[model samples]
Structure formats: structure tokens, C-alpha cells
Target: MVALSNVRFGKRNDEVKAIQAGLIAVGMNIPAGATGFFGEQTRSAYAAWQRVLGFTGSAADGFPGCSSLAELGARAGFVVDCRNPGAITKSSVRFSRNSGVAVDEATARAFAEQACDRTGAPRSWVTGVSNGANLLTLVFRESSFRPNAVNRDDVNATGPIQSDGARLNCSRGYAQVIPDTFAENHQAGTSDRIYDPVANIAAAINYIWRRYGDISRVQQANPHRDPAPY
Candidate 1:
């Protein structure tokens, strides 16, 4: 079985090779063939596959979504594990406005871009569901760009006090995620500390991908819409 996380852009692994093989099996051209690297050639081939699957415009931009990737895995005799550990019922998560010491927009954008790189999300230039700008907006709405922001009065604010002087379950960091959410969606190779800007943003991005499909669907991430719980 191939994990969906391993099949995105910038990722290089056996799962990428499997995806390349699948693309080849379906007659998509890859000059380098199954190189295990998800570069321009693999992206183009995947775009072709996406087109064949009836996706167009931004959907066929070669970035793998769970449904499309799963379909490819099925056609290639493999199973895709699209399981999302960050899956949480929206109703169970209450929203509250919280703020802390703020950073400039440029610093926040830099952190958000790092998160995009780690999570296979596109930067601002890419037109798609979730991009770096979307993440920046979400982070701003959630914590006002504060990496150490914490919401101690929200519904998730129960539990023992943590090292950061907040309850263990309080929404913390730039993305305002509770401890459980952070732990569940934490990106590999990132710090376990919930206050780390890049790690917090990456976890939030992964959670967004699983829960809402993309940041575009999140009201807080949309500039024109009134900020709401995501």
C-alpha cells in the first residue's frame, strides 16, 4: 500500500516510483521512467493522467489529490492509504479569536512557504485549492502570525499545563492547533515542539488537507469572507 503523503510533489520515495510506474502503465510518457523523484517530468506525466481522468484546469495541474491518486493506485494494482490521522469532527472543535505577540507579514509568509514545501502544497504562484497565501491568511486569522500564540479559554483548553505555560490541549502556535491535533498531523523531520513556526504550520496544512480538502474551503483563509472557525 502507498501512503498518500509520499506521492506528492517534492517527495522522493518508492511511492513516487510506484506512481511513475502507474503513469507509464496507463500510457503516460516519462522519459526518465520510475526514478523515484517527483520532478517536472513526473509532474507532466501525472498531469496527462489527470487529464485522462477528466480533471481539467487547476485540478489537472499535476499536484496529486487523494481521490485522483487513489484511482491511479487502483488502476495500477496498488492500494492507496489516504488515511488522515488529523481527521477531527468540525462540530467538536470550537473556534475562538485569540492573539499573541505578532510577527511581520514577511516573516509569516516565509514560515508558511516552508510549510508548503514540506507538505507538498503550492506556493502563492500556483493556482489551486491550498497555497502559501491561503496558509498565511489562515495563520493570521488563527494567531495573528504569532508562533507562540495560545488559546487558553477555548473548548480545547483543558488538560495539564504544558511547558509553554498553557493547558496541554490548548490551541497553540501560528496555526492555533491543540496538542492532539498537532501530534496527529505533525510533519516528519520537524520539531515536536508545538510552538515551532514551521512545524505548527505544516501540521495545520496537513490537517487542512485531510479535514477540508484545501485551505480555499476554509472561511478564515478567504480574504473576502468573514473569518470563521476552520
Candidate 2:
């Protein structure tokens, strides 16, 4: 499963090395420095980054994944031009519109599509739901999802779908995944497990299925309370 490919697969050989170097510079990673080969050491380094950041799920393998890059970019404030990506921090949306990194709607949609496709969810629905909204890639922003891959960068995390960096983990891509008590309840279908994005997306669709069956019930159940600020 870790062998899957995304845009990150097309990174130039030097870009791959730069990622390793950046991870190492932050002191939480020690991959062979992106020898242009995504091997175990790189994977371990990524896992280390997750652990440092306190991501909830498994460690990040050194496959040069977009989620990893996007999260790190968010942490580093790529879009907005911030500095330093710790496991957690007290920065605002660091990513700026000027960051050399790409931050366009089309890119966001592609990433969201990739996430949906991999999770086996309906890309059409996900895209429709997130359309035109401020979107960002969910990378290592979630503490619950970051612990295993944080390396030694002294990164920190808040809770599920929580972070204090660039808001790029906006409500768009997989990074914006939100799981509530209702999600947990509906997950009884052996679908979209909240913890696993793949399962969560599937579960999300199933969760929305209630609209036809019991949608009104769901809306009535959870009061419209604004989520806590990140």
C-alpha cells in the first residue's frame, strides 16, 4: 500500500534530495539524503517526522508522498512564506500566495481527486463538497495523524484535523478531513473508518447517505456549533 504513487513521484531527483536534506536540517530525519531512491531509511525518516509531529496514524514511509510534502510545506508555510515546521507551532497561515510552491485551485482539486480515488470514495462528491472553498492539502498537520512521521524536528500537534501553521490543510484535500462523533457512529458499516482517510472518506459518503434515509436526523442531532479555532 505504501508503494502508491502521486505527484510526489514526479519530483526531480534533486528535489527528492532537497526534501531529505530539509528533513535532516530540521534535525528530525536522517534518510540517506534522498539518494533518488525511496528506500527504508527515507521511510524511517518520514516515520520519525510523524512521531515527532504526533500524527495519529502510521509513520510516513520515504516514498516522497504529496501528503508529506504538503503537510511539511504547510508547516513551513510554503504558500505564505513562513519559517520552520515543528511538530507543532504557534504560527498563523504561513503559506502565502507568493510561496514558490504551487497553491492553486486546480492543484488542490487534483490532490483531492487523488485522495478520493485512493480512498475509494467518490471524487465527484468530494470535489463538489470542497468546490471553490479555501482548500489546502492535509499533510502532517494533524497531530493524531502525525506522530509516527515527525522525526526529530521537535514538532507538535493539536488533535484530529488540527494545526497552527498555514491553513493550506484547508477544507479542501484529504487534510481537511473532519471526523465527529456522528462519523464514528456511522462507521459501524465497516466503511470509511475515521482514523483511516480511505475508510473515513468512504465512511463520509456512507455518513451522508443518511440524508436520504435519516439526513434530517443527523442535522438535528449535532447542534450547529462552530469548531474550536486551530
Candidate 3:
């Protein structure tokens, strides 16, 4: 079985190798031949497979979605696990309010860039704002670039307060993720603390990838759209 989480871009592991083998088996050309590294060649091949599977536009953009990856695995004789243990229902989170001092745009961009790097998401998400899709905009809307921001009145506010003075499950940090969300989606090498800017943003990015497939599809990440729960 292959976990969908290990099949993203920039990942290097046995699962990526298995995915490459599957793609190659399906007549997608991966010249490196199951190298266990997911680079441009593998992404291009995966995108081709997506096209073969009738996905178009951004849906065929090489980032593996559960359905597409699972189909590939089915053909390759491997089971795909699409479960996201970190996922929390939108009903459990409320975009109540932001609390904490706001940081400047430059600082927020820097943090977001670091998060993109950690999560293997495109840095363009932070550096560029095409089609109103921008990570900075999402951070600004969620917490106004506040690294320590907390939303205390939401449904997730039931736990005892922590060192940051907010309840344990209250949304916190630049992306305002709850502690459980942060713990489940935390990047491998990042600080465990939810208040850490890069860690928080990275977890949010991973969660976005798992839930929405891409940041552009998230309403909160698009400046032109009304702020919505993601």
C-alpha cells in the first residue's frame, strides 16, 4: 500500500518510486526509471497520466489528487491510502476573529516562502499573486500576518488554555490552525510548536494540499474571493 502523503512533489521515498513505476507501467515516460525522487520529469509524466485519465486544466497539473493516484495504484496492483488523519471538518472550525499584533507584508511573505519551501509547494504562491491567488493574502486574511494570532470563540475552543493563553484547540498562528491540525500536519523538520510561523504555515500548506489539491482552489487563499473557512 502507498500513502498519498508520500507521493507529492519533492518527496523522495519508496512510495514515490512505486508511483514512478506505476506511471511508467501505464506508458508514461519517466526516464529516470523509478528513482524514488519526485522531480520535474516525474511530475511531467504524472501530468501526462492525469491527461490520459481525462483530467484537464489545473486538475492535470501533476500534483497527485487522491482519485487520480488511487486509479494509478489500482492499475499498478498497489492499494492507495487516501486517508488524511490530520483533516478536521470545516464545521469544527470557525473564522471568528484574529488576535495579536500584525506583522508587515514583507515578513509575512518571508514566512510564507519558508513554509512553501518546507512543504514542497511553489514559492510562486508567496512571491507572485496571479489570478488573485496568493499565500500572503490568505495569511493576511486569516491573521493579518500575526504569528501568534488566536481565534478563541470557535467550536475548537473547548480545551484547556495553553502557554499562549488560548485554549489548546483554538486556532493559532499565521494560518490559525488548531493544535490538533498542527500536530497531524506538522512538517518533518519544523518546530513542533503551533505558534512557530513557518511550522504553522507549513502545516496549513500540507492540509491545503490534502484537502483542496492546490492553494489556488482555496477561497481563503484568493484575495478576490470573500474570506471563507478552508
Candidate 4:
């Protein structure tokens, strides 16, 4: 799901149209048929839905928060939970990650081989010779370090400001990939799961291959040219 707007009464925007559609789909009486405008009727229906969801007073003041938008989206046949690593396929949701998902030995080997082949990195190093294993081990260690592990949330994460003085929010996923180097590099999934091991590893490998070309290049680069803030 894309980022939802935090909309309330008196605001008129394109996001309001999605909200109106969701409200109407959930059986709300949006008589104007999803007008981009937020009027009294939209507010009343939204408040009533909020009350039904057990919120009262200010909490039910017809303002749409993330949770409320998610619930509304669910009712409208959309899956809005960013944490769910699942796909809409074959008329059912297929979960991509399970309790045991991780950077197993096989996955690491295949990833390294692919990276070496794609980037023309030395076969020995890409196959975990010298400091190559260290890179692979970092992902493994991070994925094993927490209960959520690879599913760790990277949304709203911040890294130390970069040399260019941009307060980069590029750290993400099990490999903690910084993906600003490529255009439209995001995987086809929810935004928050940029940290999921499968997605993170793929994105990180691609970023490394694209940005630094090969591990040897990264090793030879000036230390002061580090892109990572940490």
C-alpha cells in the first residue's frame, strides 16, 4: 500500500478521493460519489465508522490515521498492512516470509555467485574469500540478532548525516542497504518490508553491484568517501 494521507475535515486533495472510495465501499453514505472534497457528510460517515470500531470523542473525530485508513482499505478489498510480507496471487494471499526465513548457507552462496558473475568481481572474493565472507556474515548476524530480525521495520529510520549534509534515511533491511543510487529500485511489495531478508538481500546486492561495481572497488575507494553515515 502507498502512504496514506492524514486527512481530516475541510481538506481537499487527491488522497481524499481514495478515502471517499474506501468509505463508500465500506458501506458509508458518501452521497457525492468520492468527490475529491471532504465535506460534512464524509466527516459524519467517518465518525460513525470510527465509533463502530470502538473509538469515541476525539479519537472518533472523523480524522483518518494510518490504522483507520488500513482498516478502511481492508474493508474495501485492499491489504494495507505493510508488515505482511505477502502477495496477492491466485485469489489468495501468499506469505513470502516464514518463521525460519534467513540468509542460509545456500542462499548466501547463490547470492555471492550471482554478484560475482554480474559485477565481474574476482570469483575468489565473491565466493567468500578474504573479506567477502565478512560481508555475508554481517547480514547473517543482523538477521539473527533480533526476534523480528529480517522483518525489522526501517520506515522512518534515520542515519547520521552524509558528507553532502543530507540527513539520509537510506538505511534499510537485514543488510541495511542504502538504495539512493538507483532510480525506481524498490521491490514490488509494501514499503515497510524494505527490511525483509529476501527483499533486503536482493536490493543490497543490486545496490552494491551498481554503486561500487565490485567489492574490490569498494575496498580500494578512499575511506573518507564512505557513503554510509554509520
Candidate with best lDDT: 3
For candidate 3, lDDT tens digit of each residue in 1-230?
Answer: 89887787778999999999999999999987999998989989999999999989878878888899999999998999876544444333333333453578888888888988877788877855457687888888988878878888988888765666777678888988886777667777777667778878998988877776667778888878899998
TM-score computed on alpha carbons, candidate 3 = 0.72
Provide the lowest-lDDT 10-residue window in model 3: 89-98
The order by descending TM-score is: 3, 1, 4, 2
The residue-by-residue lDDT of candidate 4 on 1-230, one tens digit each, is: 42332243455776677778888877788767888787788877887788878888656756555577678877875545332122222212111223554436565555545543433334454345333433454454445322133222356345554332323454444555443421123334423244344445544444443333233334322233333322
- TM-score of every model? 0.63, 0.28, 0.72, 0.33
Stretches of model 1 off by over 4 angstroms after superposition: 8-76, 83-102, 125-133
The alpha-carbon lDDT assigned to residue 98 of candidate 2 equals 18
Better by lDDT, candidate 3 or 1: 3
Q: Which ranges of candidate 2 are over 4 A from the true structure?
A: 1-12, 57-67, 74-230
For all predictions, the C-alpha RMSD in Å is: 6.3, 18.4, 5.2, 18.5
TM-score of 1: 0.63
**What is the lDDT ranking, best to worst?**
3, 1, 4, 2
Q: In model 1, what are the clashing residue pairs, if there are any?
A: none
What Cα-based lDDT does every candidate model obtain? 0.75, 0.35, 0.80, 0.49
Candidate 1: RMSD to truth = 6.3
lDDT of 4 at 209: 37
Off by over 4 Å in 4: 79-230
